[model samples]
Target chain A: MLIRELERLENLLQPWREFEYINREVFRTLSPVQVEFPLVNLWKNEDKVVVTTEMPGVESEGVEINVTGKTITLRFERKPEELKDGEAYTRRERRYGEFKRTIELPFNVQSDKVEAKFSKGILYIELPRAEAEKPRKITVKSE
Target chain B: MAETVKDKNRENRKIYAPAVDIIETTNNILLFADMPGVNEKTVDVTVEKNLLTIHGMIEPTIDDKLTLVFSEYGSGDYQRVFSLTDEIDKNNIKATVRNGVLKLVLPKTEKIKTRKIEVSGEA
Candidate 1:
């Protein structure tokens, strides 16, 4: 009797499973796979290098930043929006998932001194050049 | 149904059509738009007649003193338009911006029957 009841429940859920499959196919066709997420911009001055990336609707706690020598890695996860019963999405274009990106800087940075700030869903990171890596200026005196 | 319309005003800065998700319930519609770097003061939403428009202005990240060494994306403003129908109560629309995302709630107008018509049989 238990086996027969489980089979009946499965039959009832068959249509919902097919609907989920169709939904996945529709989303795949609308948006293609991208190699990178949260694309970044890098800026440099004499003192430090600044990196910025836009990640709207993401919490600061979900982001992880790591710096090793001249390389920096960013890892983050965007949580999916939840829907209540009877609510349906008419159109969807936002992308959400776990993303990881590694970037190489021009020179070694002060890993311990790196400063990062999140404001208005934009991540700003300032990596100061290591004291030993920066070029030193020397003066010459003629007698 | 919502349809996008082109804006007549053109500026030097590039304007992007921000990605949006539209959800519908029995009583109202919800819209979420991603416009990074835009805050409440910089974002604007207006409804005129049957048209609704959204605009968000973002400041440039780089200045003259700094050289952009590497970039994978371009900076721009956000603008999108949608044609609304009479079903939506435009006067009661509510909007908010948080974490660079805009959320809009459009309430559905109440259905009203102005008059009842009677049918008569003809000879």
Candidate 2:
């Protein structure tokens, strides 16, 4: 459909392309997750804010997530694999090291009501709007 | 097997080129591919005529009930091909898929394997 084509065009211009998955990101002098944004998809409805992030190789044991009302922080580390005694490295593209990022949400959400799920290397987090923060319907007055 | 080849030939559908990491070890060459939504039951790794192909069948929707408000990845099948040479032992290659990471170990052929020379004691 035309919509799908448009979306793909948009994706091509996104910063994700800057990383290029391989080749370029590997050449960066910095180590893992430095100055990088995990592919994130965010949306909001009347009652909740939902965020999904793609993290292929990160494991639960090494990952840490924290929430503070309007912000979320993720931190993790992946150790580098050492080369074998006689083997030589032909290509070095994958990167490994410590990664940490804090993201600010558009609106304040209930910290206690945040629910997270990890499936298929994607992390989904849902935060419900606080009772006080929910918009109340105003009755229209007629003259 | 038939389904995989069909999928490979599937046209007009989105296909994602999976990100890859290649590492060489003393005894083997390892490849790591970031291919989420693919499991052992659905992954296909094949070698034919010196061409190595990796295909991962992915589900279209994770949960149909949950409305997709936005998306960064238009999630689709993962496909990539690599050229293999005599240095690799195609018959003995091993692969494992866990938590969306595909680990492939290609054992080096005997000819390229580095063997330590036996040192003789001084007579």
Q: DockQ for all models, in order?
A: 0.31, 0.29
* Candidate closest to the true structure, highest DockQ: 1
Q: Which interface RMSD does candidate 2 score?
A: 9.3
- Model 2 regions lying over 4 Å from their true place: A1-35, A137-143, B1-11, B60-74
RMSD of each: 13.7, 8.1
Write one digit per residue (lDDT tens) for candidate 1, span A15-102. Answer: 6434644665586777677536788999998878999998999999899999999999999998767889877888887889898989
Inter-residue clash pairs, candidate 1: none
Task: Please give the distance, in angstroms, between residue A53's alpha carbon in candidate 2 and its true position after superposition.
Answer: 1.4
**Residues A48-138, model 2: lDDT tens digits:** 7777776777786777888897888877775556665765556555557887767777678888889888766667788887778889999
Note the residue pairs that clash in candidate 2. Answer: none
TM-score, candidate 2, is 0.75
In candidate 2, what are the lDDT values of residues B4-116, reduced to their tens digit? 88756665456676767777777788888888778898799998867778888876534444455655566667777777887888999899987687889998888988788
Top candidate when judged by TM-score against the true structure: 1
